[model samples]
Target: MADAVIVVALLLVAASATAAVAQREPARQALVLSVLGVVLAVLFTVLQAPDVGLSQLAVGSALTPLLIMLSVRKVRRQARAKDRAR
Candidate 1:
């Protein structure tokens, strides 16, 4: 049973990772990346590493995605400003 849970968690992580990579837009990619992070956390927990899992959940699912979206927003805003200046 434990093995089966681990396998399923691994599969979810793989699938979410693929989905993240397959995304075209930066915002969409970030969202998918967040999902992938959560999936990875689940996999870590399944492997009996709760500490690692919690850190991954906080960093991957939340912090990373938040940072990515902020970066994207800043870049887009700069582009718009540049366009208006031109």
Candidate 2:
């Protein structure tokens, strides 16, 4: 039972990682990366590292995605302003 849970978590993390890499758009990639982070956190917890998992959850699921999305928004905003100026 324990092995099975670990395997599932591993699979989830792998799939999400692949999806994140395969995505072309930054926004989509950010979303997939966030999901990957959550999966990794679960995997860590399954492996008996709750402290690591908690930190991963906070950094991976929240801060990373928020930063990526904010950067994307800023770049797009700048592009739009440039186009308007043109």
In terms of TM-score, the best-performing candidate is 2
- Taking the tens digit of each residue's C-alpha lDDT, what string does model 2 give over 2-77? 9999999999988999999999999999999999999999999999999999999999999999999999999999
lDDT of each: 0.95, 0.96
What's each prediction's TM-score?
0.96, 0.98
Write model 1 residue lDDT over 1-86, tens digit each, in one string.
Answer: 99899889988988998899999999999999999999999899889999999999999999999999999999999999999999
What lDDT is reached at residue 46 by model 2?
Answer: 96
Q: Each prediction's Cα RMSD? A: 0.7, 0.5
- Number of backbone collisions per candidate, in order? 0, 0
The residue-level lDDT of candidate 1 at 62 comes to 100
